[model samples]
Target: MKKQLGDSNILRNWIKGFEYCEIGFNKPPNSLVYLACTSTGRVSNLRIQNLDFYAPFPNAICSLTELNSLEIYNWTGLHGQIPSCISKLVNLRSLVITKTSISGSLPSFSKNTNLIGITLSNNHLSGTIPPSLSTLPNLHLLDLSSNYLCGEIPKGGNMGQFNAANFANNTCLCGNPLPTCFNSAHTSAPAPAPVSTTMFDSAPVPAPVSITIFESTPAPEMAPDSNSEFLSPRDLDTEILLLQMKKQLGDPGFLGNWVIDAICGFTELEYLEIYHLPGLHGLIPSCISKLVNLQILLITNTSLSGSVPGFSNNTNLNVIFLRNNHLNGTIPPSLSTLPPNLSSLDLSSNYLCGEIPQGGNMWKFNAANFANNACLCGNPLPPCFNLAPAPSP
Candidate 1:
């Protein structure tokens, strides 16, 4: 470590070889000395790794108008925004500053297309990468990973050629290389045409997809088209239901609760039937109340598991058949009291409980709709000795 210099005038004579300088980072002196040396235009390289300098950040180094390479790694106590004046170094070829406390945007390399390599990863920099950096002609090494940066990974130029690991660990990034962002709009939207899979996915086997719900004409099972690849097996009926519902509820665009919306999108629909939709998970979403004109809804033999959704707004509903699934929770009295048109509610083969609500249209259904739920009670089943819910442990 160099001792702190008291006189600034004698510092210029301390300058060493023209290609490398590791002295300043270990014991940075007054900012005046850095400016004095770099202004001489003879210092062309900097390699300051783990600099334990006690002095403040010397932004004065930007005066190195002839620098060809600059690397400062793991230098403790180096704090402050990277000076924007460094962009004036039009002769720079390599620039790297990793594992530091540098908190600012990247220093644009003065449109100097001669840049060869860069590594600004593992820092506290928090901003979008400059797309113009890709314009550098000779750049081959790039690593901007492990930052708080968020945005679409740029697809322009040769940037896509880099491995996905080069830009990983950032949230909110989406595009061709990464998975596409959530886009709903499924109805007349065309399915992706058959494209060669080799260029699209690098994985050995295609993974199960979750959110690519689009509409397409039915392909014959005997001679299925390579283009007709849907994540759901019941695509034809779902398509028909979507097309029919599309005529009634103008396309609302698919979201997380889309399956519920699609089933209930029929304001003009009278009878709806569904069976055997596999891998159905999550709570039954609550938008089913939007079906103002639905009278009969029957869904059986599905893997759906969730509490019964609100039927308060579905006054036109006459019969609701949700059996042979793993639905839980008490039947809300609001379903019987609010929907003045409800007559039949089949919640058999589920894990429901509580005294059956005794008001409004609930009395119209017989014992069969309430069967198999051992915990359920009231008029049709044996009365529970206690109406109050058991206290939580």
Candidate 2:
């Protein structure tokens, strides 16, 4: 066939034989761009970057039976939903569409088995992440960052690492991996069984090596009140093994103005996470520091207010969650005194201020946890470099 055609026409046919194509514009196109013959072309890869074109020839484009990779980036003038025909590209692997105004949930790729990399960032797309996308085995690098997406990040399959920053900017995402919704009743789903760690040293250690610990001793053997359950010895021991306990508190008859003598009793409590106790309010009593074994404390979504108590005595306390309340005054620098093992401490959507505590676990969190609190300052805060150093020494 090449012998029958002129050299010039043959060259044009030869250029079209490649399995890959990239098209872009340095300036506005003077005429419509059409590659009708390229439809039957063998191109397995197509990349269109920084180009100005609206609604490219659709149904025929997806007909590229051997197409493998497709990328469309930084073409702001191109507006509309991604062509639904994209799912027909049976051999497509990597699909990237960034900095475009494509507004839609990612179309399902049920038949596109070879797909691996998918990114649709910086778009106006809205709606939940399709649960179907989680089923892809070879797919990796799913970046939906900087979109107007909402709803919980669906938990399933091998979704690669996700974080608040990746799901930030979007006001409606929540649950584990991301922080729980600000004003919701979703219970924390228990975490998966942890991977076991091993100690490598074989040498015998000294006799008094380290102190062992239990979560809590059983409550004094009181007869079962009509409101409580009678725990058998085994059940009681199991209760003692829980590092964190969440007990529902019902209101005891006490009207508003009476001097509420004390907060609820928790003698052996280690990590107390109190939620939805509507009757509990007023000052967080200073006596809470009595629970020496407490390592984490979260008092969220309540009406409790007043100054955060000084918990300087609880040296072992690592994490503290006091979000979505009306608390006031500066966050206690005493928080910085917690043991170095502290990882996450959320104080978001509150009314606290003053520079963040220095030289401790506070460095692990980002500033959004301090959002809605206008006066807070320091590293996590934006314009953070403008913050002054902690008072010298």
lDDT tens string, model 1, 238-291? 656656644443443432122224554444554455544444545565776776
Off by over 4 Å in 2: 1-41, 53-59, 181-393
Give TM per candidate.
0.38, 0.38
The number of clashing residue pairs in each candidate reads 0, 2
Error of 1 at 240 (Å): 60
Q: Candidate 1: where is the Cα deviation over 4 Å?
A: 1-41, 54-57, 182-393
Report the lDDT of model 2 for residue 275.
47
User: What does candidate 2's lDDT look like per residue over 175-228, in tens digits?
Assistant: 556776566432322211101000010111122111111122222344435643
Residue 122, candidate 1: Cα error in Å is 0.8
How far off is residue 309 in model 2, in Å?
Answer: 54
